[model samples]
Target: MLYKELVELYKRLEKTTLKTLKTKFVSDFLKSVEKPELLEVIPYLILGKVFPDWDERELGIGEKLLIKAVSMATGINSEEIENSVRDTGDLGESIALALNKRKQKSFFSQPLTIERVYNTLVKIAEASGAGSQDRKLKYLANLFMDASPDEGKYLARTVLGIMRTGVAEGLLRDALADAFKVRVELVERAYMLTSDFGFVAKVAKLEGDEGLAKVKIQVGKPIKPMLAQMAANVREALVEMGGEAEFEIKYDGARVQVHKNGNKVLIYSRRLENVTKSIPEVVERVKEALKPEKVIVEGELVAVEETGRPRPFQYVLRRFRRKYNIEEMIEKIPLELNLFDILYVDGQNMIDTPFMERRKVLESVVNSNEWIKSAENLITKSPEEAEAFYHKALDLGHEGLMAKRLDSTYEPGNRGKKWLKIKPTMENLDLVVLGAEWGEGRRSGVLSSFLLGAYDPVKGDFVPVGKVGSGFTDEDLVEFTKMLKPLIKKEHGKEVELEPKVVIEVAYQEIQKSPKYESGFALRFPRYIALREDKGPEDADTVQRLAELYQFQERLKGGR
Candidate 1:
């Protein structure tokens, strides 16, 4: 198929704010492609990439490099391109505008094909070291020289990983379902297992529902970790779980998915990014603790001090950033692997198994020690017992407790009521930081108020929920200013717009309906809880979830 076809769809997608319309545009385009191989490539291109997040492949092309490539292609100076970027606040638009000024088109330039663009981008990402920069620049310039002005805009945006097409994973899942006449849940399940939409699309198109059913958990591929909903209290949690549940201590640390195949071990973070090379101690500990030849386990890695007491959560993050003298850092800040659940074992997928059965299987395989052990848990049918365990966890410097239903199966990537978390403080929502306002008075020169947003699955965008200016220490204000500076997209007066990369956990006194925010609901007296470095913008709380919580609060008030 011609690359211009896809570019036209992107143009339509950019014009519409409704997600259903966007999905229709994508599904129609997918249906038009007759080739199976092209079907596999289209999903990646729409997502602004050739590989999945877990593949660890990057284009390594910075903004300056992109400016140089655009200049070379359009016969424009770098200064002209840079000035246009400043005026437009977008590099892709600047490139498109620069290319549109050309008087004549190349007579020898051929029509760009889908395969040509995908292959060229892959080659650019694979380029490395020495003179690879020049090679990449040449490839990008050649492609731009052949592309139309409209096509060049999306091409540059895709290469820069900022397509801003408003097409998210949820929309793509629905589109695949519509195009292939399959169930959305089936597509979602396949996506959760493989973490590759391209592969899922190919299978759904070729093999249909049966092929999606065959998708199982693999040892090497990381499955999306199952998430939990928040419970108001121990009594509510017990009642919701049918008066019986397994209560486990909630540790404040990094969530890791460990995959073991004989001597090889790989660790993935909650965002599915590989971090095996950063934690050698974790690899060794998993190898020694589990006796199975092949398995996939989920757990938390908490840093501890010399006395074996758990350290602050931030201390554990230092390990992820270490590239030199890793062994020395490992010794200085040792980590304890607290095993919670198992997903796969011995070539058999355990996600279909019941929680209690999986727990028994996990307990049998792990040889618990000081450094590697199961999470402290208690099986209780009484709310009093669950309450006691919750306090005990807090006394031990842990977060709170997680109450899981015994009959519940592991539902990958679904945040249902099967598992619920109860903390001592008010309820918290994981929100995306959209922008910030500059501080005033003693807090001048730094950002003091943070504009928060929640994910709207229907719109495939972050909707503004509220702003937060409290619950941050002076130290936090200074650190956050440094952290958010690089993400600044445009500044207007004291308000700075951000790229929506940072996720923060926020606590609120109540949820109120308001027309002032786009989400139609806002958090009353919202305050910053902590920076959730472990999560991404996609993992933030959804608008639907917030509405559900508001309804639950109303029911509580009526019952009282």
Candidate 2:
């Protein structure tokens, strides 16, 4: 397809705020994609590329590169190309314009199918990591040649990993369903259950819409988060919900959904990204304990202390980030899998069931281990009880609690009043200062926002939880950046990792289950709370602890 096709779709998507239309537009484009060349670049561009690291000046420079490319091909001035591509932030469009100007005709003429798309992605993934820079560049260049003008545009943006698709995941799900002439809900279930587009296409083809509807978490499939609801303290959420509402303890561990079939374990995140290989310990534990051939459960993956208390989020994260010598890390960290709720068990779909019902099933069916256990449960009648529990949790050194309505059904991906979170002490934590960017507007010279993260057990690394730019004066910001510059380990696009030494307290509005962050949790409105000068990285909180906090709040809201 020509880049013009995608541009037309993007324009249409922007014009309509209607959920159905927005989804349809994406599905239409996905179906319309025809370039075999685009497949090589699209996945890397959309899923692998990182943009959060670019400075304003670097971003401007990247844009200038595109403008130059466009100007070289077209008679238009560089400024005009830059201006045209500004709102879209897509360099591919400039390329498409230049091509169109040169060709004087449309270049895209075929329908893009799922199989062709996947084939291209597989090639790209295969070539990644070990491929030389020139080889990668050639691979990219070839994709452009093969892509139609519209495909070229999207492919270009994809290569840059700048997917400004107006359509979100939910909208895309809806669009895919409509495009295939199936119910939106059914399509969603299929995607959630399998976390594989290949399965989705097969289901669409084999069972039609009904086949998709039948897609429940089975031996190999698991449901994904449809929406993530996060909050600060219960009081704030209560106000957001227009007075009293149930709440749950938001745990401080990795947010994971586990699927078991007999002895096999497959783990996925709220984002539906496959993470089975990342957290092998959790998988082994689930395999030993659950032993179910077809079951899917959602819970926290945390690290524990010698005293059996939860460790910092970083401990569990380290296991996930490292590839070599994982056996030792697994034993050292010893990840615990906390099973909270069941999405599917046996042949039944529990997502439509109430929280209490699901919990009952979860408790009755699954046995907890030292590493993989059930979250604590509590019942609260009034705000006072909730408050009391919240304090109790804090006294136990937990982040907070999650409150959930007993009657609420699992609404995947939607953050509603159904679940609420409460945290203790708006205070300090031993968090890693991931990167520093120039402050915008008034905060110009000094670092205003600092990206923060707790550790992931599986990766043995720090993934973003939130950014902290507050709590620092100009002098502190300048000193902090200068002090931490030498700690830089490596640069991946816009993100810079230094030795995980600079620990800071991040004041966030609330804790949320996130797919964007690799560790599976995010802080709402996270700002720099304070710098912990006296702590080491080892003293930082772990993923397990966060999971415990989230789960604790959940029990309270469930009236456990």
Candidate 3:
């Protein structure tokens, strides 16, 4: 597939909002995609070569390369290319302009197909030179060589670490569903079950769209959670809900989902990345806590303080830092797995069942020992009572409460109102941790500040919206380094790619527009609250909401 073909498809998908129409459009195109390489490139074209979890990165392509490429394509002087690219903050646009000036007509035209795109991606993903620098450069060069003009443009942006693909996971899911002639829910189900788009395509081919719908929850499939924020106190949450809700004390700990299959135990973070190796001690605790032959239990891993009370998220993070001496660290900062929701037991997929029934089954399967215990929860009809419970949680030094709807099915990765969060003033908006800068001065050894973002529904990607650096202690900084070190994938300019699993509450003075951050926004005086163990990436506030908040703040300022 030529780069132009992919761009044309992207252009079409970009215009449509309806999923049904999107599916039809995609299916129509898929019928013609005979090339296998095109199939492979679709993932990289849409998603990118690196998985969301990688964090470590090198500097992006230098200006020198941009100038050379621009000159080669346009017959322009290096100085001209440098000035244009630097002023625009976009190397791709510079290349595009140069190419256009050189030729009045299209120089290369080819149709995009599954085969061509897929082959290009395979090359990009597998490109590795002798050293790390060589590997990165080779990857960039292969991308330019294989991708069409448009593909090369975007591919260059990705290599430069500029992910300006406004389309988001939800929007992309809709597009995939449209392209495959399946329902959005079905496509999402297949994605959650397999986490493989290629697998999804195959299933869509064999069983058709409905086959995608029949995807069942299996032992190894980790479902995303329906997340909520805490309403002031539990009392406020009750008041807001007008008396109908269930309240559970939010634990200050590492969130974990333990899948026990007889003797084998696999633990995954909320983002569905396998973290079995990171928490060896937690694995042992789950083993002793549950006797189930096969089960998936979702819960928190809280670090107990000296007073036997669970400490903040920092303590739990410390246990992950070490590759060696893990046994001693596990003994030192031993964690308690606080089970809350259960999705499966034995061989049955219980997610389709109501919460009440699932909770009963969860209670029956696990022994409520201190190290591996069920989290406390209360069902109430009165908002007043729920609010009172909220107070009790904060008074106990716990984060507010997680109020879940009793009748709603667990819709993985969707933020339905079924699950509402109520937190203290300290816990405000959950900002996606975008990029972390090296700590300065006293905190020179670790990451101290994080560039954060909110989801932009229209763009379909997280938009840089804020930053938080004030609330964490030195202890928290050290702990975060241990936890965040491995999740790094690519580093470009001031941005990064991290597994969207970790969500943190941040308090900001205000929001403002800025050119420095790709998000075109910035936060004023932001501080940390807590690690949101209950919230998923999809649950984070949208960019639209952030814009609204900013506008509202402006209104207040004008009134004052």
Candidate 4:
């Protein structure tokens, strides 16, 4: 397919708000592809991403770099391009305007295809070390030189990692299911197994439903981690789990999926980005401890003090995001592995195995040691026993307790009463920062006021909840400036639009219905607790979860 054809499709999808029609449009388009390789690029490009969500390599091109690229393409100055961006409040719109108003036409230009554009962007992402930015600039400038005004708009958005077209991952799943005439449930299951929509779509189109059913866990590929919903208290957690539950310590650290095939040990974070290079000690520990030659397990990587006490959660972030001097940093902030679940062992897939049986397998395959061992857990039918277990976890500087049903199967990416998180306090939401405003008074020149958003799983987008400016120390304000200033995509007056990558935990007194936000809800007296560096925007609280919390708050009010 041609790049212009895809851009035309984007324009059509933008004209309507109904998702059913949009999904149909994409479904019909998918049936017209001439090449199978295009299948892998089409889904991600439609979402304005250069790579899959799980891939770690990014375009690295930001607003200023894009300004330079646009200027070189249109013969406009950087100052003029920046001013146009300010006027339009969108970089894509500014690029469109600049391309349409170009003084000279390129006589050597030819139509760009989807493959050409996708390949060029991949090269831009892969370029590294000395003069790599220049390499990226030349490639982007060439794309702009050939793009139509409409194509230029999307190209700019694509480089920045957002399409702004209101398309979500769920819609793509629906379209893939419809395009191949496969059962939607089967398609969803295949997706959960691989975490890659392109591969699932290809298998469905080529081998049909039977092939999807045969989808098995691969040792190297990371599956989406199964999630847990919050419970009000110990009694509620116990009741939801059929009067008996396995309570495990929930450490305040990064969750990792460890894959071991022979001596090669790979670790992926909660968001599925590979982190094996940062934590070399984990690889060594896995090498020494595991008896099986091939297996995949889930665990927590917590930073520990010299006394073996767990460090604050932020200390773990440095190791996860490590880029340089890894050996030195590893010794300074040590980490311990806490295994919780097993998904596969040897040649067998264990995701469908009952929890108690899977635990037995997990224990049987491993040689427990100080560096690598199973998590501390308890099986109890009494509420008092569970409460005491929860208190013990909290007293040990852990987060809380995780309640898992003994007979349930692991459902990737599913959150419900099957697994519940029991914390000490009422509740705190893990939200993403959508935007931020410049600080006022003594805190001037920093981004202080944050606009918070919650994820809506059905719509596959973020909805505004409220803003928070209090509960931040002066040091926090300085750190915010360093982290958020480069992520500014657009600015108008005192407010700026961010890239929506930063996640933070928020404490709020109440939830109320309000028309001020897109979700028709707002948080009352919301304040910051801490930055969530281990989580991504997609892992934040969902709108459905917030509505449930709101109803619970109302019941408390009535009882009072």
CA lDDT of each prediction against the hidden true structure? 0.87, 0.59, 0.64, 0.86
Q: What is the lDDT of candidate 2?
A: 0.59
TM-score of each: 0.89, 0.58, 0.65, 0.90
lDDT of 1 by residue, 1-560 (tens): 89999999989998998888999998988888888888878998887767776766678787789888878887888899899887887777888898898544667999899999999988998998899999999999889888888888889888867676778788999999999988899999999997888888988899999999888877888999899887878899989999899999999888888999999999888888777888998899889999999999999899997776678777777787676899899889899989999999998889989999999999999999988888889999988888888999998888899999999999999889999988876557989999999999999989999999999876679999999999999999999998776457778999999878789988899899999999999899998878887677888888998987887777567734
Model 3 CA deviation exceeding 4 Å by range: 1-45, 50-167, 192-195, 229-236, 239-244, 382-388, 432-452, 461-505, 509-524, 528-540, 544-560
lDDT preference between candidates 2 and 3, better one: 3
Model 4 alpha-carbon drift over 4 Å, by segment: 101-107, 129-131, 444-446, 457-461, 474-502, 512-521, 551-560
Order the candidates by TM-score, highest first: 4, 1, 3, 2
- The C-alpha RMSD in Å for every predicted model, in order, reads 3.2, 12.0, 8.7, 2.9
Off by over 4 Å in 2: 1-118, 127-153, 174-212, 226-250, 312-319, 323-334, 379-390, 405-408, 425-468, 471-526, 529-560
Local accuracy of candidate 4 as per-residue lDDT tens digits, 1-560: 79998998888887886788888988888888767778878888887787765576778898889989888888988899788876776778888999998766679998989999999999999999999999999999999989989999999888876576667778888898898898888888888888787788788788788988888888888898898877777898899999999999999888889999998988888878778888898899898888899999999989999888899777877898788899999889989999999999999989999999999899887799987899999999999999998999998999999999999899998887788988876578999898999988998988999999998766557889999988899899899887876457778789988877789989988888999999889999999989887677767888998987887667545642
By TM-score, who's the top model here? 4
Q: Note the residue pairs that clash in candidate 4.
A: none
The clash count for each model shown is 0, 91, 45, 0
